[model samples]
Target: MSGLLIGYARVSTDEQDLTAQRDALTTLGVAPERIYVDHGLTGTNRARPGLREAMAACRGGDVLVVTKLDRLARSLPDARDIVAELTAREVKLSLGGSVHDPTDPVGRLLFNVLAMVAEFESDLIKMRTREGMKVARAKGRLRGKKPKLSPRQESHLVELHHAGAHTSAELAELFSVARSTVYRAIERARPAAPSAS
Candidate 1:
């Protein structure tokens, strides 16, 4: 008797669509019902609930299918760990319709090569992102998250806080901000303490 075909898919960002991967998996013989997915989760994150569920769903002789090795793991160590787990559990891995035979030397080599490529790609992405941010910063365009409250609003909030007419909760409600925000604004308004000589 043949075992079940379990499918897994993932996307690094919420904006990225999973339709292409899902279609590919279905075309490769994975049933839609058996497909597990993780959204807005990076491959480098090993604690994905979807991946865990798919692995747990597999039994001896069951095949775990993925459209691409990168979708399964972005790092070589993670890929190796996953393969080790699968081998120990007697589960087979099918990458893009090609079943990986751990017992074969060539298959092992190919798997390692694919994992290295994935890791390289991930490293390149990180490097490019850092360089891009550096350039943006040099051009004065890489300002981080904007403050939640405007300068004028923050000043008024601080003034209201100093007035002591309202409690922190009341100030938060009045300003439509959190109590922490109120506290931060007050803290910001404080004069800097004298430095020790």
Candidate 2:
């Protein structure tokens, strides 16, 4: 008798859709109710709740299925750890319908190669992101969030604060900003205290 097919799926960002993965898992004979998913969670993060649940749900002779190895894990160490746990528990793994036999030399080699590729892809993505950010900074397009108040406005706010005519809340209301902003402006304008030699 065949074991139950438990499926797992994951997406790195909230913007990425899971419909295609779900469809694939269902087509691979995993029941819709047995499919677990982690949204807006990276495969490198081992603390995924859905993954934990899926692993806990597996029993001896059960099959854990994923559309791709990258969906299961992005690092070679993580992939090997998960496979080891599954193998120890006597659970089988099905990657895109191809069952992985851990005892088979060819299967182990193929799984290792796939895991290396996933990790390499992840490293390339990080490198590209850093390069893109560097270029954007050079172009003056990567300046962080703009200040909440202009220099002139901040000076006026400081003057008003020193006059003692209004409380922090009143200043905030007058400037149409938060009381924290008023306090910050006053702090920035304060003269540095004399330091002892």
lDDT of 2 by residue, 1-197 (tens): 77899999999999999999999999999999999999999888999999999999999999999999999999999999999999999999999999999999999999999999999998998899999999999999898977789999988888776777789999899889989998888877767212210
Candidate 1 has a TM-score of 0.74
Q: How much is 175 displaced in model 1, in angstroms? A: 24
Residue pairs in clash, model 2: none
The true-structure Cα RMSD of candidate 1 reads 6.3
Total clashing residue pairs per candidate?
0, 0
Q: What tens digits encode model 1's per-residue C-alpha lDDT throughout 12-86?
A: 999999999999999999899999999999889999999999999999999999999999999999999999999
Model 1: number of backbone collisions: 0
**Residue 125 in candidate 1, Cα distance off native in Å:** 0.5
Which whole-number lDDT from 0 to 100 does residue 141 have in model 2? 84
Reference-based lDDT, residue 31, model 2? 99
Q: How accurate locally, in lDDT, is each candidate?
A: 0.92, 0.93
Model 2 TM-score is 0.74
